[model samples]
Target: MSITEKAHRRSSRSLKALFGVLFATIVLGVTLAGGMSPATAAETPTPAPAPTEESDFTNTYSIGGVLRNGDEVLEGVDITVEGDGFSETATSDEAGEWEVVVPGKAEYTVTLEVSTLPDGVELRNPDAASSVVTADQWLTTSITRSFPMGEDTRETTGFGAQLLQRLVSGLNFGLLIALAAIGITLIFGTTGLNNFAHGEMVTFGAIVAWIFAVLLGVNIFVAMAIALVFGGAFGWVQDALLWKPLRRKGVKLVQAMIVSIGLAIVLRYLYLYFIGGETKAMNVGLSEAVQLGPVRITVASIISMVISVVVLVLVGLFLTRTRIGKATRAVSDNPSLAAASGIDVDRIIRIVWVIAGALAALAGVMLALYRQVSWDMGFQILLLMFAAVTLGGLGSAYGALVGSIVVGLFVELSTLFIPADLKYAAALVVLILVLLVRPQGILGRRERIG
Candidate 1:
């Protein structure tokens, strides 16, 4: 109330703001510098340290295969993969995994040298020693080729068992999707914008973490934590620089959406410019699988799933119990009324953006762990997020959560009867069917429908 006290409070707030901006700027700079590091680290094309073995290259696309004989993995098998103007050799590790990084998408011939195989291990089919495979561009994780070796009789997993495994896998995927989808819904609800650039937000998280965890050799967990902070900072910056100004300018919803599309294009290409158009992984190798009774999942999958669940639970609590959260819902329901009632609508929207960015970034990190990280990876997931949001009901966060699980399960399980490529189409088909039956979506209130 006193003049000195007011001055002190304002100064403290300014200092805090200054520190926050500094932190955000530093994070952004670190990642941008990382993107440039690879290009600058070498004067010209040169071999990275241990290039033939596990290397510290920023490129992520590869031709990979697993050599196994029924129950036994074949190690030290020399495999060579050659693409246009590119050739690499990889020896199978103890886990039967061998991958040769490729420059980009192209057809390649892969050959397994039988002489290098251990005495007892041999190619099951002499005719299949060499095979040609095609590498897919645009977010294809790894172009996998299979070579069968040796034979000890082991029964194939039953259909029931396979089904259970897929269901669990779908749940794991759904949780991550839920993270991004929930964020999407929050932004859509409060702001009435599709926020297509959100996908880039996802890509940012993965690539940033990839820089720290893989290239810089930082601990994976720490890299992920840093990624989360950057993700939140990204949202804050977007609000302060872009969306808030548009809102103040009385931008039309359609116009604002068009701006997001342009923003998406700019950001995505910027990513490609800095990071190149290759896939990258956040964590090295793979997580060991943990069997849970009838189902098996990787340790990283477990951690990601646990993180998603806990965050969702916290979000639920915040929405239902906290005053700010209740205000958020009120704003989502009707911003003008909430604003008239003394709720800070713009502030609430900014909060929503920050939360959405953090969640989407986490989804991106999880994606890098299981799948491949690429510039357009978030764009791929963005389609599913849209489907989930629409299927859950256009503007409902809880509905988005339920819809994401359904979409994830259907996308994975549909592979049983449909081609894997068609599975995504199948999910969209299901969304169409659901909308036809009940346009409001699962968990959507009746009032949501026209």
Candidate 2:
């Protein structure tokens, strides 16, 4: 054969081989997508996971606020979501009135700023008349607030009256669940161990809080603190006795998770033996209603939300700022490499367990405050916690927070249409959908897992 023709044939053969290699790679990726080990994927930068929906409840109610400076209406004022179960923001129109749509049965507040309102113009309304609005949020209730120029406070206009009550109730429930779910996600993200005993950890927190509040006659805040400390110690002991030894013995992650299941049952029955399966409330009495517009919210529920936010923020800061926290992040990111780098993997793991336990305890106490406490409280929430962890992505702490919030909102908002009994089922449905479409979760990178 001519030299040119032979060279052409060689080139064609090379091209065919390249195509075959590419085809095989695509096949491998499809077949072993989620099964890949994390170490392998770390060599190549993986795509960020897709964002999850924050809330599924669409706005069905509209509230318009008119801001004015003297005779001129202040146009384009920004209005943000305020109060319970509220999300969404808007800007004013040329007429100085800003209209915002919110989910029905949700409570909201509209605040406007004007340049000419004097140095400290405050507004107050005596009758607290709510504005008229349209809503489709749970039960289709509507209310509104109007801010008149020079008035110290605005009067609510056009509301159906019961809208605020429903919003507050839904929001309180959502926040409590979100708190518990965060702890579940945090542990799962770092340990690679599904701590089934987590439910018991929550129970322990509530029980401790109860003991302080009822038996010992301590303040609620102090009781919560005691519960957190005890919970952390309990977690540390569990790591020292059970998980650390199992890990050192080279047990597989799946095996460790199964062992956790056994521990969960044991702890739960022990709780039953002592606490007696009856529901109990914190001893603090709260009968006062703080009414704004058509909504009436209790002081306790408001306190619960503030505490949840503070805890989330402080934990986030600690993880980002402290050396041990950074080390913990590294270990969670990759334990083998972390150990190779001379980091104390065991210590980090212990710390993670303690923190996780503490958070779980705090969450439990807060939840009991929102509702009533029972031995089965944590067990009832276990599945939802798992859903939040999976939905947010397995090893990302912030992902846990985001996932919990998402799940909480989804559960509460779905009740707008479905029966309250089935709201949690909606969260499960969402979890399944997320797994099918993007198993890596909202904040997880789609990399290999060992």
Candidate 3:
């Protein structure tokens, strides 16, 4: 290449790099200054014009812009409007110009949204801030405004403030569902019966926790402990009184499952009869955010996550290292063989019940602490639990854990593109697709496949 041509290319590259850095800095400043999360980027409100005398009624005003990052125009970008209680949308053409006829008189937000952000660049939307907007001037009837969209902004969350909202929402949903799904998966792995009553077990824990907090006047932590203990105890009693005898009678696995379903209904309404259908808060105030980079997490959420991790670790150790744990695994693998080999299958079953009950209670208490406790909390999570188990492969604790995390994260993240109301539907759809593609589940063993 000629010297002049090489020099020109080098200068262009350097300028592009500098512009990228500048864009990121500006975006960060704009979002952080406004206390808006980076995920919600592309939320810039229109800079209102200076107020003039008369207000003109116009149904729409034309807006056009070259979506660009520095000197380059970005193609295939989505632009949306908000505020004025009405919205209009448009997409950039091949030349990166977009036009929309938006409702006039009131100011509106113009946002640049795309599914993924360009590498090493993040932009924050100014509109996500709590700042209010008011028009100081009226647009000339049928006036056209052109905004010179700047270079792609530098960012960690490439999509900006919208991504942050999605992360938080997903984390919330995943954490909530994990509480119950984990327990269901654990119990199923250890025992052959599908315990439909597991849902009631969770509800019982929440109601008991509520009782302690409301009537006993105990500290929330203490109340939670009480719930956990009582929940474990309930599981023990159910095994001793119902499941154990049924097993001894050589009842079919399907029969045991049916019995569990009946027990679930009985126990569920009994809880409802006593507690009613009202929603109750945990009443423990969690007021601080633990900032990690661009993401802010609350104390309650951190605590819940920590507790789950610790419990799962302990469960892992108990199952792998302890003698009793070995026996439990043996029974799960083959009950008749384990019994014939002198492993105490009945004792293992009882212990499994206790563990399942404890985990269920813990999930219930954590969920209640993070959100509201309701009479139907268990039922609300039942389908999700089924999805996790099916996704993780039936009868695998490790699979369940892995599956729950996947389901939880995806369902939560879907909120970015999907309406919040339809997030659960996305999860089910993903679950069905996963099943079709890999019937054994993500972590399920090939041997376990039908």
- Overall lDDT per candidate, in order of appearance: 0.84, 0.72, 0.71
What's the CA error at residue 153 for candidate 3, in Å? 21
Superposed Cα deviation of residue 183, candidate 2 (Å): 3.1
Candidate 1: tens digits of C-alpha lDDT, residues 178-211: 9899888999999999988889999989988898
All candidates in order of TM-score, best leading: 1, 3, 2
Cα lDDT tens digits, model 3, 110-189, are 65564533453334443432222246444453433334433445555556765775677566656556656656766676
Measured by lDDT, the strongest candidate is: 1
Taking all chains together, the TM-score of candidate 3 against the true structure is 0.63
**Candidate order (lDDT):** 1, 2, 3
Candidate 3's C-alpha runs over 4 A off are: 1-158, 168-176, 287-291, 448-450
Q: Cα RMSDs of all predictions? A: 11.3, 22.1, 24.3
Give the poorly placed runs of model 1, Cα more than 4 Å off.
Answer: 1-154, 284-286, 448-450
User: Which run of 10 residues does model 2 get worst, by summed lDDT?
Assistant: 126-135
Model 2 segments beyond 4 Å from truth?
1-171, 448-450
TM per candidate comes to 0.71, 0.62, 0.63
